[model samples]
Target: MMGVAAAVFALTVGAQAPAEGSDQKRRLIEQKIRLVDTLINSPAARGAAEGQEAGSRALIRQGTQAIDDARKALADSRYDDAARLADDALRAVSSASRRMSPGEGALPESAQRKNLQDLGDQVAMYRNSIEELSRDAQKGSAAKTLLGHVDGLAAESRQLADAGRVGEAGKRMAEAYKLAVEELSRLRAGQEVLLSLKFDTPADEYAYEKKRFASNEIMVDMMVAEGRAIGDKRHLVDGFVEEGRRLGVQADEHAAAGQHAEAVRLMEQASAQLIRALQSMGVPVF
Candidate 1:
């Protein structure tokens, strides 16, 4: 009789456990749905969807689909699936909001000024770093190009500020800062790649060197495009740019003389110097 009672109790507990889990899952799904709905209805989300270009359109579409799927899952009593879909919708809508331009949403005067001031400080810091670099080496074509972009953006930012379009001005300054930071990051990555260079054969070493160089070239072009997209420019001095050019030239010379190992070594030295320059400019490499 005791064994029979024990078996019945175990069965009852097992049934209650699944019921508890199902209830918990359902509650979670409901909470997620509410959160996603709130985000989708926010001013930022509306601005992104209605005021922005193609990118925001795509994100909105994605979020809409996720919301629809979540609703369907909820109706079918698929709690876990509903939760997952609702979470995805939330992320999609949030990302769309972030992609909206500052022009779409006006900031308060005080807020705008504060943002602009902070961004201006960052840009000034980067420009100062570039100036320091200019003292060491002749600014290369790349550096010149970046400087032109920075100057143009800085001018535009000032104009916007004068016109009382503080939000737009702050956005431009922020973009300029981001561009400078990204370039610093790219240079640091290239330096690390060069430092890690090693190969068993001369052919292998040469191939790797070419590959790394090509990669850096592509990264530079991409960085330039990114800056342009945001109406900004990287701030890098001539000296910093010249060091990379010199290293590449010396590596090519070594490679031409069939000194693959020496070529790799020179490339590494060049990258190291670039990294050092970036660090000196107060860019965090790690």
Candidate 2:
């Protein structure tokens, strides 16, 4: 009986060792995920909002989904899976952050005069594009608004350069360039282009849809806040805000049902409505 008990005890200890190791790994992964989350919510992330890149957007969506999956796995007592998923989340967000960063080659500090000149030329090109877009009666307001922002950024960049802050100046120019590119793309490809999602699989599509819905929900709140701050005294913007909320609800339903494409469409519609409302209230969407 004593020998049998010893063998059983050894088996239990061996199993407990692996379990403990897994738990330790899970904890470490959780810590890493938290660190990555900080990067995801950092200023660079905010800067990334100035424009969209398919790869960067995909990474963010993948990271968000991975984090959620990790938590669910943890709840289900799949500690090893949880750790792996959490690590994946960390990598995704880190990659996304890196992708969103402005190219080092474009930094003004690298070649101050050349970069500045290039930026100026690009700004000029965008100005022409904006002018052409503004000719369309339907897009006039949006074109004007975007042009205003671009002009403001261009002026700021020049001022920063004058102050010997070439790097900062280059950043401003970079932002302007991104904004211009997005606008041009929209004008050329229609509004839906702004909402386009390129994913490797249905799972990727679902993840992106889920993440975009959350983002649009936040945008709705921002639109409302800005509208109120500006005193939508006439409540002219209320209709658009309400429509955005309604669409967001529909988007949530679609996402829950795994109708990712529909969810993305609704989320995009909601975002557009909110952006229009904000623009009407003189708030810059960017």
TM-score winner: 1
lDDT of 2 by residue, 95-117 (tens): 56545333332222444444555
Write one digit per residue (lDDT tens) for candidate 1, span 192-222. 3222334689757665555444333222323
**What are the Cα lDDT values of the candidates?**
0.56, 0.58
User: Cα lDDT of model 1 overall?
Assistant: 0.56
**Which residue ranges in model 2 land beyond 4 Å of their true spot?**
1-23, 102-160, 163-286
Which segments of candidate 1 are over 4 A away from where they belong? 1-43, 46-79, 105-118, 138-152, 182-286
In Å, residue 239's CA in model 2 sits off its true spot by 50
Report how far off residue 61 is in candidate 2 (Å): 1.1
